[model samples]
Each structure stands twice: as C-alpha cells, then as structure tokens.
Target chain A: MRFIFKTAYEQDIRLFKHGGQQFWYGLLGVALLAAPWVLDDYFLGQLTFILIYGIVGLGLMLLSGYTGLISLGHAAFLAVGAYTQAILAAKGWPFPFSLTAAALLAAATGIVVGLPALRVKGIYLAIATMAFGFIVEEVLARWEHVTGGNTGIIVGQLQMFGWTADSEESFYYVALVVAALVTLGVLNLLRSPTGRAFVAIRDSEISARSMGIHLARYKTTSFALSAAITGIAGALYAHKLRIITPEQFTILQSIEYLMMIVVGGIGSVHGAFFGAAFLIVLPQIVAMVKDYLPPAIGQATGLQPTIFGLVLVAVILFEPYGIYGRWLKIRTFFQLFPLYRRGLFRRQKAFMKSERLR
Target chain B: MQVLQVVISGISQGLIYGLIALGFVLIYKATETVNFAQGELMMLGAFLGLTAVTFGMPFWAALPLAFAGMWVIGILLERVVLRPILGQPAFTVVMVTIGVGFVARGVVTMIPGWGTDTHALAAPFKGELVRAGGLVVGMEHIVVIAATIALSTALYLFFRFTRVGVAMQAASQNQLAAYYMGIPVRRLNSLIWGISAGVAALAGVLLAPITFVHVNMGFIGLKAFPAAVIGGFGSLPGALVGGVIIGVVESLSGVYLPEGFKDIAAYILVLVVLVVKPTGIFGETASKKV
Candidate 1:
C-alpha cells in the first residue's frame, strides 16, 4: 500500500513537472481524438463550433499573442476568406479549389492592410488596422455584387471525394482534422527560425532588426500567415453555416476574437484552445443559468453586453497574461513544488523593465 | 468659380477636422497614448452643447459652460480610466479607452429624449451666407476661422510664457527630466487632458452650426485622427496643417474623383502617409535606444 501511494505521486509529478510535460498532454490529445465518437449530435455541433473558432483564435494567437502586432480587424480577413469561398463555390467552383482561393485572397488583403505596420507600432498600428476593418465593412455593405450586399448569400455546401460534408458528424470530422493539422503546422512553425524571428520582432523590433531579422518583411509575413489561417477558418465557417453575410465579419466580432486571445493567454499555443472554447461555451452557459436568475437581472441582460465587457476588463486587469498563462504558472509552481513562487506578482515587478522597452 | 467654391468648402470642412486633430495632438503629446475615445468626446461635447442651448440658455452663454464641463470630464476620465493602465503595454490602454468609448456611446444612446431624435442646433447664426468672388461661404466658416485663430493664439500664448504651459511642454518632452526639474508630471498630464477636452468642446460648439449638432457630427474626429497622423501626431502645428491637408484632399476627391470616394479619403491619406513618409511631414524620426 505504501509503495503504491509513493508510485502514484511520483508518476503525477513526473508527467506534470518541468520542460518535459508532454506525457499527460499526449493522453489528453488521445482523449480529444476519441471524443467525437462518444459525443451526442448536439455535443457534436458544439464541438464543431469549438474547432472552427479554435482555428481562428489560433491564427490570432500567432499574430497578436506572439508577434505583438495587435490587430483589431482580424474578422475582416475572415470575411475575405469566407466571401472568396462563398462567391467561388456559388459560381460552381470545386470546394478544394475554393478553399485555396479563400486563403490566398485573405493573405493578399492582409499584405495590403499590414503595410501600415512598416511605419507604426502599438496604438497607431491598431488604428490603421481598424480603419482597414471599417473600409472592408463599408465595401461589403456597398459593393453589392461581390459580397451580395446586406442581403448576403448562402454558401454552397462543401463536398469531399464525391461525399457531401454536410451532416454534423462529417463537418465535425473535417473541422477537427483541419484544426488538428493547422495546429500541428503552427506548433512546428513556432519552433522554427521564422517563429523565433516573430518573437524577436515582438519583444523588440529595433533589436530584432539589429540582429539581422528584417522587421518589415517578418511583420508583414506574420500578418499574412495569421490572415490566411483565419481565412481558412472563415471559409470553413461559411460552409458549416450555409450562410455568408457581412454581419459575420463585423468589428464587434473582431473585438470578440481579441477577447479570446486575451482571456486564453496571449502567445501560448494551448492558450488559443482555451480562449476559443471559453468564448464559444461561456455564452451558452450564461443563457442556461440566465433562466434561474431574477427577473430584473434577466431583463437587464437585454441592455447589457454583460459577459463580453466584464471578461475583457477582468482579464486585462487581473490576469493580463490570461487564463492559460495563469494555468501554466500554477502547474509550474506545483512542479517546482514548495518553492512558493507567485507568478503574477513577480510579473508586476518585472513590469517597470518591460515599460521602458515599449 | 466651381473649383473655387469646392476649395472654399473643403477648407471650411477641413477646419472641423483640424479642430479635432488638435485634440488628438494635445492629448497624444502629453500622454504617449492616442485616445481612440477622442471622437466620442467630441460627440459628447456636441450633445452637451445641444443640452445647454436647448434648455433656454443662449448659444454664447452655453459655450463656455459646456467647455468647462467637458474639461472636468476629461480630467476625471484620465484619472479613472487611463491613469490606472498607464504602465501597461500600449495595447491594454487602447482597449480600455475603446471600452470607455463603448460605454459612452451606449449611455448616450440610452438617454430617452436625447438619442431617439436628432434636432438642428438653434445656432445664433443659422441661414447666413457670405459671398467672396462668386464663391459662397457660410458665416460659420468665418466664425470657425476667426475662433480657431483666436483659440490657437491663446494656446500659443499659454505655451510660450505661462509657467504651467511651459512646464507641460517640458513634461511631455521628457517626464523624468521634468520631474527632476520640479515639474509635477502627473498633474501636467491631467491638465493636458483637460485642455484637450476643453478644446474639443469649443470645436463642437463652433461645428454645431455647420454640421447641425447630431450624434454623427463626432465622426469628424475620425477624419481628424488621420490629419494628426499625416501632420505628425506629436507636433501641435503639424496637426493643424495635417487637418487642412486632409480637408483639401477630401474636398478635391469629392469633386474630381468618382462619387462616394471622398468618404474614404482619410484612410487613403493614412495609407499614403504610412507608405511614403511615415515620420510624417513634420514629425521627426524617433531614434531607437539600445
């Protein structure tokens, strides 16, 4: 009995400890793979949502979280992707070809939007990106032909290898596979030299440039990559919903994406997953509990944006590093066991140094 | 004659942008953050002016009071929303101000009597026009120019010799050195915010006649931001020139270019500036410290 107790504790510590924490992570990955089979139809739909948004959030994680280019208009890129796919597919193009076009078109638009980053940083860049968002939205509403205007158009259903990817099960499988592949691709890329360049530019662009990283090119390229990924997610989303409208790509949606990155923990790969899942699930959970709440509060939910504003302010104030970052820290604290490390407070002390960097 | 009329109108409209751009420059200089809520501030000021004038106060009588009220509001906003997030990454402050903007717009829309209808400001100088060589200009244009000049002169005087003004200049240029030199940096920052909001209120008061004091009048601030950027965000004089440039460019675009293009001219100007001369026409390149 004593030996078993000691063995279990050691196993937990070994899996949870230090840099080599991939063992339990591997188990979690296997569980996720098996999840779709056991999930009911409704749960399958929710999982589909998680997978789609997870891809979008992952793209954002790379841009805002890692590269330090805070884009408030990512939804515009998603629209570009969605519209491209929708328009092409509506015109009787193949799904596979439409998907490629969607990503390329979104990437092209991202390059033009990202041109502002060459000259500005931080707030100015944010404003520039926002302006681009507004312009894109205005174009969508007014152009009428390309976007189908405010009336919007339904996207043709996706097909794969003579099989319709229509049912919840098939959609979930497709999204899951795409999400998994993209997640893997991102994971691999982050370990590469290009990812290092992104981090370097983000930490200090001047220093990064000094160290022979081309600031303009890397920044723009990172933006293009982020946009392309988001575009893929958007294209997938259009097929999933069977509707493509300018409303799906509004500035508010862009802000929601930003909230996801912030809440999930900026710059962490795992953070994107948490952020996407939280944003998708939290509102449904709110709606569920909302029935039990008092009448006045329920009525106020009509006036209140509620969880959206509260979560944004709370995360930025209390958990600036985000839930994922905090989770990582707590896990680290236990692994470092009995070390009494307070991660957030230590971050505050280090802030002065960070302040001067900006 | 047609071209002359368009140019005059553009210059007149540009003055509105310049006024708001001045607001952007004023706050940006003192605090390194560009308040995205500046446009909403202008909107609030116009709405407040409407309140003052419509509630039986004369236009001139309400103008100064409105300015004073907004100045106080600016100070309060800085202290409450901005000051706490002062040391965070520029992104956090940006989002916070964005939230503040959202709340202000929501609150404004929530007001029962205020938002449901849009009423023209009972301007003391409504329906009046001036003709210069067949180019028609509204009396509002003359007032805007005269009032803008007067306001600019007063600001110039304040910065040139006044103890507080020069101290603000010192602090904005260098906080640590100003602090070492016995200038209260935080106080100066608050004061600058007050002045920015005050100036914005004055601009709104003048703009009420021309733009008719609607919730949408504040969109002028969006165009003005581009003016500040094109003029160099840090330079006060640059903001003025930038505003004029945007005004002229937009005016020309509306007349000469395809229809509906002028609405997007500000963004085009920003894109051009970002691509061609990002340091702006007047802003000096900031050297990176190792």
Candidate 2:
C-alpha cells in the first residue's frame, strides 16, 4: 500500500490526497472532455444524462449520506426546478437568470419541507417528504394554466446570451461544465467546518447537539443546499428532455433517485457518480440481454422493474457499501495481496437500534 | 342524508386503509422497520385471490388461500431476505423492502393472465345496494366494514389472550430482554411478519370488490401512511381510526372542495398532524437515554 506522511495540517483537508489522486483525476477529466469527439451522438447524449443524474446524486448524497436525512420526495424539487426553468424560458428570460431562479425557488420549497424535518425523524421524515412529493405532483397536474397539466409544457433549447446550444455536443459541454463545478463545490463543502457539522449530526444528533452544533440551522441548510443542487439538475433535465410533465416527477422518480445514491454507495462522492453511471448503463445492458432470454420473460412489461429490484436486493444483501464500496474492497485486496484478511470488511452485528425514542 | 351516505362510504374505504396500515404497524412494532412493500403485498394478495377464484375456488375459499400464501411469503421474506440484514440501518432495510415491492409488482405483471390489466374480483356482493333510513349503501361497502370489524376483533383478542401474541409483544418491547426471558425472538419476528402479511392480504381481498384488482391499486397504500401517522405509528386501533379520519376527510373533500383537494387531503392532514402532534393521537412518547 502507498502511504503518505502528512507533515502539514493543510494536507489533511486537501481535495486530492496525494499526487496519484491528482494524476488519475486529471486523466479522467481529460477522457471526459474528449469523450464527445470519440463517441457518437447517442452515447454523448447518454453521458450528458449521466452527468445530470450525477449532479442529483451529489445533492441526495449530501442530505441522506452525509447528513443522515432521508428524503423520498426529491423529485418534487426537480419538478419545481424544471417547471420554473420552462416557465422562465417561455417568458424569454436569460438562461443564467432563469437557472438561478429555479435553484432559489427549489431552495425555498426545501425550507418549507425542512420546517417539518425539525419536528419528525427517521421513517416519519421519509413519509413526510413522500407526502410533500405527492402534494407537489398533484399541484403540478391541477395547475394546468401554467404547467399545461398532463399535456406537458414544451421546453425550448438552451439559449445563453444569444448563443443557442442546439447541437448535442454543445449541450453535453454545458452539462459537463455544470457537473464539474457542482462536484467541486460539493468536495470543497465537505472539507469545510459546515460539512463537518453535517457529518457530526449524521453520526449522532444528540452528540452533535452537546458539541454546540446548532441542529435546526444545519439541518435546514443541508435540505436547502441539497434541494438547490437537485433543482439545477432539473433545469438541465428540462432542456434535455424538451418537455416538462407532472408525471415525470413522481414518487417512483424519487425512489429511483434514492436507488441511484444507494447503488452508487451511500456515503461517498465517487459513489454518487458511479451509481448514476450504473443506472444509465443498466437499461442498455437489459436491452442487450433481452433477446437472449426466453421470449415470454423478455417481452414482459415488468422485466425492467424486476431486474432493477433484484439488483437492488442483491446489492444491499451482498455489498451494502454499493459499487464504489465494492471497488474499494477489490482495490484494497489487490493492494494488500497476501496480507489481506478474509474478515477485513465484515460488518459487526448489533441489535436493532430503536428509532421510536427521540 | 347525503352527508350520512358520504360518511358511511368513507368509513368503508377508510377501513381498507386501516387494514393496510395495520400491516405497517405490526411489522413496525416487531422489527422496528417499516415495510415499504406492504402495499405491494396487498396487490399480490389481490392477485392471488383473483387466481384462486379463476381456478374454480369459491370467493370465501380464495380469501383464506391468499391470506395463507401471503403469510408464507412474508415469513420466507423475513427469514431469507430480512434476517441477514437485521442490524443494518433502518434506511437500508427500507430500501430492501422497496426492492421487494418492485420485484413483487414486476413478477405479478409478468404472469400471463395478470399482465398489466385491471381485474374484477367477482364477489357475490358486487352490485347489491341496501337503503336504510333514506340512505343507500352498497352491499360491497357493508361487507368491507363487517369484515374489518371481525378482523379487528379477532386481532384484539389474539393479542389480548393468546400465548404467542403475548410473547411477540414482549419480544417487540425488548429483544434482548425477551431473549433472556427465553422467548424465541427471531422466530416471533418471522411469525409477526407472517401475521402482518396475512392482514394485508385480507385487506386486499376486501378492497378488490370496491376498487377492482389492478397493479396500481397498491398506490392506495400511500394514503395509509397518513392513516398510520394520524393513529400514531405504534397503536393498532390508532391506525384504523386514523384511516377512518383520512377516508372521511377525503370523501368530504371530493364533494365540497375543488377537484384536486381530494387527492391530497390525506397528505395535507398528515402534515398538519405532524406539526400539531408528531407522535399522533395514541402514539406513546419516549426519549432516548444518554
């Protein structure tokens, strides 16, 4: 194993821990930037979607993974962001301003949801967010005057300062830049004292309270930030899909977001991106494998959900740390070689911790 | 008379919600984990009942078969899938249940006869109506209410008087202590899951008459969240009462309020309840020791 001796405090919070990380990340960045040229338009479009979902995964990871707040209604925030972007775009607003407004409105709604977070917790919190999601979906459907109801509102192309991003490659670049910035922003935030507070709260709220961390403020802040990030992704989603519908943002969509973060690895930034890529690639794999299976099973409408569900169960049972966690294990095993023990990653069994009491 | 009619209908619909919520509370009370798949279990139960009926079984015979089948599936689910991950975080367990739900729904759809189509449960009570005191009530509604009452009474007695039920309660209260006391906690948990699943199946069969059996019918289980919350999460009677309240409010809203309010009435009520009394009507309040 490669070990680096940290001589300075600055080294502790460095974004790239060592030269190896920096070099690998740089290589990855170059590959992503050059992907549009090497890959066809269809693959580029898929990459753009992965980037967008990665942004959402980042937001969800911040709230659920780092902060320990579960939200089953994040798709509502996405809907808010998408609807705002579409409405503003229709009004001939500039892209930057409209995007900012979308984020702000989503953040505002997050605060509203967060108000209840202060009172409830665990499953209750999850249910509350779910309820909020359902209500938002209903509102979107009923408010046809603005949202166009079930017919869906058409979203225009990305128009930034009179430069319309009509081509797939241009849109891909836009998504790439935004995703990089958001990822960087998240990385920096996590290393900060604010991020530490979030981790603290997640680890133990009572302990965090005793340590002088303001619980209400940080919780709301996490919700707002998470919502804002998801909102941005939603804006990009609207532009990509070219149509905004109420059905697009439902409890199913929220669960899919949860699935993305969980399958990626719950507590790691790398996991978020990995999970997004997995989600995007899984459908393609399914489609490819469909013809190989029996026609009855292959042609069934429920095939996708069944596969997705089974995958989720298998992942949780065998590898709770997700794909990123599995990657870490494989890397560690290879690095340690003969020295690696069998029980290196075994989870300690404990009795169920009751969430009934505050 | 019209108000009474609405109220009566509301009670019947609410009973279904209560029944599903009861499943939620039972599993929750025992394992301290919410089964996101409870609704899907209900859906599966309905499908099983429909299958039994199609196979030349009587409606009464079909109901018990579905209940028994779900009970076995629930026990297997607990022992095979859930038991291994017992000590993990609640969120992880919840995700697993969600995965189970997806598999259940998907598998149901893949079944040749049950493929993404709405089905009617062909109950003997299907189109009959009873008019009493200037108010007309569907025979189906009466059957739902009667069946719910009978089930609730049976459950109440089971918990109150049975040895196994008492042991299950002890286990739920404190697993370690119950183990020390020589109670079979793990086995009890599996049994509790079976019982919960059986209850959900009963709800599904009863509900099939009113809504018809469809894959999406499980979505009504979402409304049961509000019911569970209103009645408090831990209390059995609370779940039914909460469901009734939600159902009545929804029924009233559908007629009195604008078109959309009915869809969200339960959720809005849940938010209000969370704000006003987070513990719910009969919810016990406790604080963790340092």
Best by lDDT: 2
DockQ by candidate, in order: 0.28, 0.65
Residue A27 error, candidate 2, Å: 0.5
Model 2 Cα shift for residue B175 (angstroms): 3.1
**Model 1 fnat?**
0.17
In Å, residue B174's CA in model 2 sits off its true spot by 3.7
Q: For candidate 1, what is the TM-score?
A: 0.85
| Candidate 1 local Cα displacement, residue A30, angstroms | 6.1
Model 2 Cα lDDT, one tens digit per residue, A1-358: 7889999999999999999899999999999999998999999999999999999999999999999999999999999999999999888888889999999999999999999898888888999999999999999999989999999999999897889999999999999999999999999999999999999999999999999999899999999999999999999999999998999999999999999999999999998999999899999999999999887788888889999999899989999889998999999998898798879998788666565655
Model 1 lDDT at residue A160: 49
lDDT of 2 by residue, B58-81 (tens): 999999999999999999999988
**Which residue segments of model 2 deviate by more than 4 Å?**
B160-163
When summed lDDT is taken over every stretch of 10 residues in candidate 1 chain A, the lowest stretch is A349-358
First chain TM-score for all predictions: 0.89, 0.98
- Candidate 1 Cα errors over 4 Å, as ranges: A1-47, A138-145, A250-252, A277-310, A325-358, B115-119, B140-142, B160-163, B209-219, B287-290
